[model samples]
Target: MILESFDRRTIANLEAALERVCDGRPDGADHELRSFIADAMVACAKKGQTTLGALTEAGEAALARRGISDRKQA
Candidate 1:
């Protein structure tokens, strides 16, 4: 599996990116957003962009492409 190819910290970066973006959202309400970040992170890893910064940026960019902002509007 793709995950088996990644180190713990690298995978943690993916989770960290999600938590950062999805913070304060109700449970079960972030499925779509979570998937987007996960997919983007994997795609980045597959393309050899495995740095934490690169992966996090990729996740954020993916959300932006979907019109999902980094922080929820007040």
Candidate 2:
């Protein structure tokens, strides 16, 4: 399971980043966005980005690449 693979702190950081990137989505649990967040977190963690700020930046960048603006939906 994902929980077994990563520590709680890492998971928390990723979750926070995911929330930021998913701010405008109809559903925070959207599969594609979740996948993107997971991928970005993994990539950033591998590069030693364990901090929330770094992970958030990475997540935001990933969203931007997919043309998913990180803003609240109307």
Candidate 3:
């Protein structure tokens, strides 16, 4: 749950990274980029993480807008 508590700044960084991975390709991202993003998300989900709910929600909404759903398995 701590990952769910990440601060705004941290979430911003993660969002930026996600964006980078998403926008790096001309046609579209490949499997490698997707895996990298998934790994980054997993790393971001570890305990002790602190994220702002508002920021996280904003990021989630953005991802949804882009059709990039969270791949984090429950």
TM-score of each: 0.69, 0.72, 0.37
Residue runs of model 2 more than 4 Å from their true location after superposition: 26-29, 68-74
Residue-level lDDT for 55 in candidate 3: 34
Instruction: Give the C-alpha lDDT of model 2.
Output: 0.79
Model 3 worst lDDT run, 10 consecutive residues: 48-57
Which residue pairs show backbone clashes in model 3?
5-50, 5-51, 6-50, 6-51, 6-52, 7-50, 7-51
Positional deviation of 22 in candidate 3, in angstroms?
1.4
Best model number under lDDT: 2
Computed on alpha carbons, the lDDT of every model, listed in order, comes to: 0.75, 0.79, 0.50
Candidate 1 root-mean-square deviation in Å: 4.8
The TM-score measured for candidate 1 stands at: 0.69
Q: How many residue pairs clash (N, CA or C atoms closer than 3 angstroms) in each of the candidate models, in the order given?
A: 0, 0, 7
lDDT of 1 by residue, 4-69 (tens): 988887778777766766676564247876887788888998788877788878877887776645
Ranking by lDDT: 2, 1, 3
Kindly indicate the candidate among 1 and 3 with the higher lDDT: 1
Candidate that scores best on TM-score: 2
